[model samples]
Target: MKANVGTLDRGLRIAAGLILIGLSLSGVIGLWGWIGVVPLATGLFSFCPAYSLLGLNTCRNRPH
Candidate 1:
């Protein structure tokens, strides 16, 4: 898949995901934090299915 997630977007997603995971593991965020894995995976892979279906590209014009 094309990299529809840019550096900044990926970074944010990763950070948010890590926080959610951390909080959940620490018993501070509850079960909702489990959803963070989705963003984590998307950021780690630089691809998001929703973005693809919506014709969105956060990494547009980016080289690499």
Candidate 2:
């Protein structure tokens, strides 16, 4: 998939995902925090399925 996530958004997502995963592993946020993997994957890949479906691209340098 094309990159739909921008730099700032990707950074935030990665940070949030890491925090959630860390909390989960530390038993602070419980198993549900594992869901952070979704954001982590999307951020790493620079793509978001939901954004594509909604036609909402945060990327500013998409090729025409």
Candidate 3:
């Protein structure tokens, strides 16, 4: 899979995911906070399946 996640999107996802995980770990939120791992993993991988299906590319445009 190619990198469909752009820098900004990846940063946001990582930030949000980290916050979720942190909250859960700190008992500030429910275990559901761990669900943020999904976005985190996707951000790390830079490949989002939904983006692929939707033809949404957050990554930079390449020359044809």
Candidate 4:
């Protein structure tokens, strides 16, 4: 997949994902927190299916 996620976006995704997972594990949030995996994976992989489908690109170093 193309790297549509940029550095800032990736960082935010990762951070948000980790926070959600942490909250879930700590019981601060319900199982829904597991959804954080989506962002985490997209962030780590630098590819977001939704972004691709929406024709959005945030990575300056990569071409859509």
Instruction: For model 3, state the Cα shift of residue 62 in Å.
Output: 3.7
CA deviation > 4 Å runs, candidate 3: none
Candidate 4: residue pairs that collide: none
By TM-score, the better pick of 1 and 2 is 2
Residue 46 error, candidate 4, Å: 0.2
Better of 3 and 4 by TM-score: 4
Residues 1-64, candidate 1: write the lDDT tens digits. Answer: 7789988999999999999999999999799998999999999999999998998888957654
User: Lowest-lDDT window of 10 residues in candidate 1?
Assistant: 55-64
Instruction: Write out the backbone clash pairs for model 1.
Output: none
Q: TM-score of predicted model 4?
A: 0.94
lDDT (Cα atoms) of all candidates against the true structure: 0.91, 0.93, 0.91, 0.93
Weakest 10 consecutive residues, lDDT, candidate 4? Answer: 55-64
Q: What does the lDDT read for residue 63 in candidate 1?
A: 57
Candidate 1 residue 31 Cα shift, in angstroms, is 1.6
Off by over 4 Å in 2: none
1-64, model 4: which lDDT tens digit per residue? Answer: 7789999999999999999999999999999999999999999999999998998999988642
Candidate 2 local lDDT, 1-64, one digit each (tens): 7899999999999999999999999999889999999999999999999999998888889778
